[model samples]
Target: MIRKLYDVIVVGAGSMGMSAGYELARRGFKTLLIDAFDPPHPLGSHHGEPRLIRHAYGGGAAYVKMALRADKRWLELEEATGEKLLERSGVLNIADPDVYSYEGRFEDAAVHGVSIESLDAQQIHERWSGVRLPDHFRAMYEPNAGYLYSEKCVAAYKKVALQAGATLLTHTFVTNIKPEKSYVTVSTKDDEFMAAKVILSAGAWFKTLEPFVHLPIRAVRKVVGWFEPSGKSFDAGAFPGFTFGNASGGYYGFPSIGGAGVKIGRHDTGVEWRPGEELEPFGTYPEDEDDLRRVLESFLPGAAGKLLRSAVCKYEFTPDDNFIIDTHPEFSSVLLAGGFSGHGFKFSSVVGEMLADQVELGKWGQDVGLFSARRFAQEDN
Candidate 1:
């Protein structure tokens, strides 16, 4: 069989890869997107219906700019596709004032010119009666922060990519990637393809590329549960997406949209996962549900009525819990984007743009030093 060639090959047609393929094809680059499974499937991280998007980031001021850029990109995609991808239902970041400080989030908001409101416990209670915060806790509210329809976002990007003349091969597993001095070759079981540039956005399966580009990417298993709300007060129109920071970790949830009930998950509850291992059933671990129930009973009692259903997902975590968007240290023709750490779906739009920029300009068109894989290399020295 003859080998196919292209200007760029994106290995992983999920969130970031699909967006990158769209952007590259829009720019008139001959691009190919290959994936192990058809996306919008429950196999990857981008599944679950909704993902939170917030500009006032508590992660760091470094991320606020990216969040802002992502917000614009999401709106642009919505306009292009004529689809409602984002819902501005607002987001509440609540925590005990003494334990965890909202100072970083506040500073990030101020620096990025993001509008936010500081609310004490009583004020939070009065504004949203469904939420029951302790008198000592406080909250930071961002009116523009909300949830993005994750599945819809990926589908939109894939559709636009196909319309722009990009080729997509789903259910095609990439077995190897070999980077040469002039071009990179990608091999599947049946065929081989060459591309002037390559992008690896393989999410949890990124370790499969360890033979070519070894980055410290770890896959972690996580669970999210849906609970039946007691009343309409927890509906999308009345309630907003929320996160409560605690000593053990943080817990977050979405409002009941379209009578689907409330969906909640723990941010810090994940165990190291190896690829190819069987994923246990969602409710197999009783402690998972019990832990979420404890948080709901304490903070948002009205939203936690009955155990509805549950699902499992994986997060690719870096040692620093930040993203990695740099060229492979040994292969300049290949770029990598992984280690989203469960908070990356919202930034897929801008990240795709950044990856395209790296392919064409040899730089990301912005300062992303914080997310560079070189940080780990430096730490070793």
Candidate 2:
């Protein structure tokens, strides 16, 4: 059988994979990106129209640099493609005043020089009349951080990657991967292709792929809902993207952009998903709408009129929610970039650059030790 060859083969042309292909193609590498479905499709995490981009990362202080870099790249892409990709609506985080609900977020902002404003509940309610929080809850507002038009961002990357000489095979599923001494072979049932290097970024289906079977990641199903607002107070132009959290749990949301209604979703609620199975629709479970309704009724009662629309997606989570963007332990030529958990779509641009740097220079420009897969190995000892 004949084998087609390229400099890099990126499996899973969704958010990270597509961006990596774009970066590699721009660097004059012969790249091929193969995906099971057309990207920016409704099946993945990047499907939702908008994704919040916060520089004062709640996850850890180490992420602020990557988040800032990703923000810059998003703006650069918007300028280059002339696409309306980022919505600068700002982001407001509501939590208890005394308790640091968002771990390391304040420290991250301080270390990165990212500006943020602290507001008490009364001040928050006064500024955004639609929001009603308990007096004990305080807020940290990042005026410069906002939400991205996620689907549009993926579409733009796909377009420019092709323009930069990258080849993409959409609706083509990779059945197996075999790493060799000099090259890696990717099989798609009917054909085989070889590349000098490969990026295994299969997202939610990461565990189902070979050479990654025991990668200690799980695919989980998640849902988000859009509700009709009672008035124009919830309009995207006037309202900001927001997060509400405490000792109980956390919920994140976006304002009604383009009359799409106020979109909301719980951050930590996810049901384990079996790979290769069709995703259950949004309303399959009662909590899908009920959980979101509970949040809206408690905080933004004005925006919880009726359920306008809903969608389901997947999240690939590691034991710890941090991402894993390192080389495969056994294969130097195969890079692994998955286990984003959640809160990763915002960093897709910078992550792609990091993976590209790893491919060409064999090292990342930034210290990504926090995301290394070896952390799990170390924990087991």
Candidate 3:
């Protein structure tokens, strides 16, 4: 059968792919977005209700610019869609001073002129009565940092992309990708499609495309839990989204939103997940609940009331947890973006724009050298 031709084909129409599809379609490209399941589905990464967005990035100073840019684009999307996507309830990064250093974060904030407030453990407890921090822990609060409604963000992107004439194929699984000299062809279970440029934003399923783009990405299963808070202190009005760092890793949580209770998760604990394997049902991992309970008991004891519910998600990690956004080394027509590590959902807005720019202009506006796939190649040397 003759395949349909599009200007750009976006695989995995989740957070990053949907945004890129919107940008490409808005630019008048005949864009086609394909996904195994409908987006906003629990099977993918961007499913859980809220994801934190912060300007004072814990990842590194180099990411501050992208984070800020993503924040701006999110606002633009909100205005365009007329949907409340971002909630500026602020964010707190607390860490034991000896284990986690905030010096680089402070320098990044100062250099970028982003607003950040430093607070001691006493100050933190005084400001939010529900929190119990030891004297040795330090905190940095970014008033602009907050949470984004994950499902709503994806829906808004999809709405805008559909309005802009992007074709979406839900429940369609991609079987293979073939990159030619000037164009790329994508094979789905039902049919084949060709595009001038193809983007593989396949999230946890990225390993399926490993032969085309050899990036060391591993899919790991992680869990998040919602708990009933004892008092109103954990509400959005009083408490902010927070992260607590330690020698092992960190635990992050969001205030109770829409009566969903305080949602918490550990950033460091995830087991390697093989693709095509059955994913465990939600609330099946009792150990995850125990770990989260331990974190809440240590930091915000009042927030750990009852184990309301839990869900599992996947994070694709690179050797270095930074994202991989670059053209294929051999086939320029094929672009790849994955390895978001666990903190990529917030930047989906800007990442989409960058992917679209890569396809349309042959370059992106921002200095994306930090996320370049070539870095891994250089590291191998």
Candidate 4:
């Protein structure tokens, strides 16, 4: 059956889409949040026990402003849900002096006035003596940056969205979107949706949406895993979460949230991937296990006491690895929040607000001019 009309239709109701739906519904709009699965599922990207929520964007300083506002919204959601979604235990970034992570993040802190502390290798060893660190490694500590219960956070938004009169259709895979001058026609296997506006937050499926809107997003499959740290001192407190970058590789992870282990994964392990193909096969990869073992062997052997669990998630990567949150080229009715590149979870809250404005006011107040689809047409990535 075809739905008669909707103010907004959000595809892929995981973190960002659900939050947007919740916001729209709260604003007295008839919103629909559709998903391929019920969510909090293994097939899609927004899983795992927890995710690191760091401020002081290593990506750039412009993101810092957005992140600060987003951080506030996360706190607001936490208050609404009455669930502790974020942990302010802090984030430790370990890298060399010349590396992008250390120096850039340091600059971000200075530029944005975000609280940060730069530490020497000895200082890092002193502050957290539980794990091993290289002698030449420098560290930047952002006290506001910590971890978030990502799946639970999404679930909270979904619950509130339903409460606000938003309709959520689970197991509805959106196959096509055709835009008319008036509205967009969205189709799924079981039903069709007609909405005044549409938002494409379909995560890894961003590439497939290019025909609908020319988004220069490449979906890449990346691995995240938890390790059973043998030493009790290797616990969460003893092991403040971190994002690392070096000439060899960069990675990030949470402390022992599962109570039995420390979780970690390499950021750049994904060579290019095609969706539904290598994005996420039916199960884990043997080479994935070998890769985690290799990383642990190179970095923290104690935390890698056991590969307790492992899985893969796809990151919708833009050429510049930044997000695209703006209207489509030819259609004002279709909005997009694509190419998160493994870092959009933290900004989901404020991103929803921006998208809501795009649907209602015809433009967002924020300076997302950098996220335009036209950027791809230029030479720079």
Candidate 5:
């Protein structure tokens, strides 16, 4: 027997899914959120303590605008829920001139009227003594950017979504998704549930639904670690969240908030992963700590004392490192949101709003043309 659940069913209530569920339910849609594990859990990508939120995105014009919308929505959510989900710690992006470029970011910021301060290596060092950069390095500081308590954000969304009359099923793994002509059936171990519309934001687990919706998304194992700081300057109040880009790769980090130490993670390079497979422990690979340590030692030596703790997460990547936020080609009722690459968490708020907009209005409210899965059609030929 199929239990017709609600107006919409959100699968994989992680960062994007949780926000989507919250938006859908709060807007008076009966929503059901099904998750394999209790959300805000460490098993997925959103568990890491803090994720960066930047406004002057280097990605593109649409990204910058989307980011601004997301920033507004996040603040609104915080105000509505009375939850301290975001921190206005600012963001600093440094790149070696010879190795990389920040021109695209500056252009995007200019086009969007986002404030970005140009800083040379000396200025960066003076502004944040903990940051040690080469004389040739250049930087852009977005004063309005900061970090989000990711897990807390998800938890808050879940709570508010439930209060808004959304049904949540935790620790229940989805076994299958069958999209019919008019409705979709989501099957779990215990029962089959049907909904008129569905939003799929399953992160790495999106692979499991290949039979119902095929997206060119791949999961990659990534790691992040907290390190003991050698000085108080690396504290959240004194230091800003930062990103460093060079010829080798890129790394992102946060200041020590609540004395949790400085959190650091490499933005590029990780092992390809599959669903249901175990992600080796953080230290399983020497580079997990060593790679992060090398960046800290080079730039923020003050924050490179020792490893406080570490965790592994997955990055659902698309072929072009863009995002896949479009409807399933086969089923218009099923909205697909995945392959955020690594910089997706910050936009969860707005992405959720757009997903819900697509369900209710037959199209995304924002200009998500760049994220259309149809862009991959050329590859098929």
Candidate 6:
């Protein structure tokens, strides 16, 4: 019968939306954040026990700016929360010296001005014992790389957001949107509301939600495991996190802390999938765990002991495997933050600032040309 209005109504109260809502409300904007489920749900990305945060991104030089900014924000959040959400455990990329450490690897870091170190197999083994490199594989190590606690981070953000006076409506689904010249209409199951602006950060659902706007984002299912290694197999300090690529494995993992075991997953081989279909069956697929185990068997036999727990989450993928973080061309007031390509969690805080900036100053001060939906202009209606 009536409408509730806000300066900005953010759809999907997950990583991106919650981050945006926190920043917006902190900046004194009237904001509302809505989601179909609770924060840090395994239904979308930013799940599993942890997500990797590496400034030396494998995507390309285009992300150098975003990655660096994200690093700063992560530090800022750490200060804000006083919770140990990020670990500076560092990240290692293990592959044959000739391949993964090629133009893309070294050049991306150089272009982004991020620091890196190349290590021989022996160096990796001696430096980090939990690490198991193949016979001839070398490594490119990024010191700033680390891991993030996905669920805890979301909890931190949600708490900060509510403290800052933002309205967060969980278990609420936004069914549709109607954008007008001066304002936008947002419809949930129980109510209709008007918003001066809208940030469409529905993650996996972004592709279908904005078909009329034409985005290149697609949703893919990713499975990861929290594995309990043999208690005596390796010590925590010896187990530096690593991502391996070769004829054998393309998996990444962490060391056991407080008997948490080594958490591992293969990133490149997620199943083709959609959103919202009883995520349990899709969440813990039999084949996906097997797919990751194959990596453990090849690379780290003693460490990949048994799967203690596992989860399936969806990644919003773009054609270039980068991210799309800008306002929609058709609806300037409607910003889109999707297509994280399975590597968007670490950037959530910075992306929050970017979305907030777009809704405020009109630019995030970072050159995100490569991430613009305009790059997919053929599909960019």
| Runs with alpha carbons beyond 4 Å of true place in candidate 3 | none
Q: How many residue pairs clash (N, CA or C atoms closer than 3 angstroms) in each of the candidate models, in the order given? A: 0, 0, 0, 0, 0, 1
Whole-model lDDT per candidate? 0.89, 0.89, 0.90, 0.79, 0.90, 0.78
lDDT of each residue in 1-381, candidate 1, tens digit only: 569999999999899999999999999999999999998789889987899999998668668988999999999999999999999999999998778988888888887799999999999989998878778899999999999999999999998999999999999989989888789999999999999999999999988776777778888888988899897998997899988897867888899889888999998858788878887777777877888888988888887788887888998889989899988887888898989988999999999999999887777966688888889989999
Instruction: List residue ranges in candidate 2 displaced over 4 A.
Output: 97-103, 211-213
Query: Candidate 4 regions off by >4 Å?
Result: 278-287
What does candidate 4's lDDT look like per residue over 1-381, in tens digits?
856689889998888899999999999999999887897676666887677777777667668888888889989989988999988879988876676646677787787789999887888877776546678777888887888888898899998999999999888778889999898999877778899899988887765655777677777777877778776656766678887777767778777875757777777757567655745541356766666666666666777776677777777778888788878778878888878888888888988989997777777757796677778877654
Q: Which digits, one per residue and each the tens of the lDDT, describe model 5 over residues 27-114? A: 9999999998999898888988899999998778888999999999999989988999899899999998898888988888887899
Pairs that collide, model 6: 130-238
lDDT of 1 at 164: 96
Candidate 6 steric clashes = 1
Over the stretch 1-381, how does candidate 3's per-residue lDDT look in tens digits?
A: 579999999999999999999999999999999998998799989988899999888667668988899999999999999999999999999999899888888988999989999999999999998989888889999998999999999999999999999999999888889988777889987799999999999999887665766788889899999999997889987889999898757888999987798999888868889778888766567777888998898888999888887889888898888899888888888888899999899999999999988888888867777888899888889
The TM-score values for the models, in the order shown, are 0.98, 0.97, 0.97, 0.93, 0.98, 0.92
Which residue runs of candidate 6 sit more than 4 Å off their true CA positions? Answer: 97-99, 108-113, 207-212, 231-235, 280-286, 379-381
Listed per candidate, the RMSD to the true structure in angstroms reads: 1.1, 1.3, 1.2, 2.2, 1.2, 2.4
Cα lDDT tens digits for candidate 6, 1-381:
578989999998888889899999999999999888888786777666677888877666656667788888877777888988888877877887555554577878887678899888788778765556666788888887888888888888898889999998888877778899899999877899899899888888764464546677777777677767775545455566778787654677777766777777776766667655555553456777776777776667777777777766787778888888877878787888888887788889888998898888888767777678777875545
Q: C-alpha displacement of 285 in model 4, angstroms?
A: 4.8
Write down the worst ten-residue block by lDDT for model 1: 279-288
Taking all chains together, the TM-score of candidate 2 against the true structure is: 0.97
Task: Give model 1 RMSD, 1 decimal.
Answer: 1.1
- In candidate 2, what are the lDDT values of residues 1-381, reduced to their tens digit? 678999999999999999999999999999999998999898778998789998998666668889999999999999989998888899999986565565468777988899899888899999999998888898899999899988999999999999999999988888888988899999997889999999988898776685544577888899999999988999998999998887657889999988999999888868998777889998888998999998899889999988998989888888899999888887888898999987899999999999999999989887788899788888999
Of candidates 6 and 4, the better by TM-score: 4
Better of 5 and 6 by TM-score: 5
